[model samples]
Target: MTGIRAALARRWPTIVIFMLLGPVLFMLFDMAFEQMSQDPGLTLARLGNWIAEDVFFVPRFVFMLGALPAAVVGALVAWRDSRGLASGRWIGGLSAGFGIVIGIFFARNLFIFTPPPLGAQLAIGARAFVSVVLAGFLCYGLSRPFARPLLSQEER
Candidate 1:
């Protein structure tokens, strides 16, 4: 639709930033997961082996290789979007909304596998609700500074 395209046109930089950094963020998270996947003793053994094999380079490799491009691209997007208040607000709010939506999807996945302890489930659901609300509020707050100033400038 024209509306969707127009909106994207206005916030393309933010979208691209999200796209570019998303993978790096994902890989960062993946590294954490990878570490978790290894048992402590096993991890030590592997570390020893890496050193013995001269591959102590493994973990550092991922960090060094993956982090820069992602960070740079993300920074570029953030800088571009930071140009003006109006577009910045729009971009920030939408990004927050998207994050909350994604959080909901993750919550749904968790709900199905969640233990059925009645009170616990209630607590989890409440926590999820609170998290979503907080995420939305965070987005709104971040946008407010940009939006308010932009609107005031327009009025003048």
Candidate 2:
């Protein structure tokens, strides 16, 4: 238990960043899934209508009002986490964060008969993997200027 505590003590910031950024990352992921699928439109429309319907869109008001603000905040969080190499908290936080989302969707289905299609499940899973790559590149790009110089193998 103390081992877990000690690890958490050292990694809390990483974990918290993941917790904060995971959902926004997932939302950003919707665009990728749509690009890959037959219906090449924002999947956010399908999910976000429950929140707000007439906020903003390229052609129409598809994305909800909160989306702009959410995007801004998400960007900030991503930038905040954009230092150093990926940490163990990245994996742990992704699993834990998505677990909560899955739990919420599961509970929602208990009350409502409608369930999201299998594509949505595939998207969620794919997003988990894709997010790592996307976030890693973002971190790499953001940290490049501040990163220390690398050396040849002999230097190590």
Error of 1 at 69 (Å): 26
Query: Candidate 2 lDDT, tens digit per residue, 28-138?
Result: 554445444656555556646623442434212212432443344333333343434443455345445544554444334322456567766555555544544454344
As a TM-score, model 2 comes out at 0.33
Backbone clashes in candidate 1 total 0
- lDDT of candidate 1 over 1-156, digit per residue (tens): 565454345544444444444443433343333344456633546545544564344445533653454344334444444453234444455445544544454335444354557664454444434443343334333333322324544597
Name the best candidate (by TM-score): 2
Question: lDDT score, residue 88, model 2?
Answer: 40
Off by over 4 Å in 2: 1-26, 41-113, 117-120, 149-156
Task: Give all candidates' CA lDDT scores.
Answer: 0.43, 0.43
- Residue 46 C-alpha lDDT in model 2: 60
Quote each prediction's TM-score: 0.33, 0.33
Worst 10 residues of 2 by lDDT: 57-66
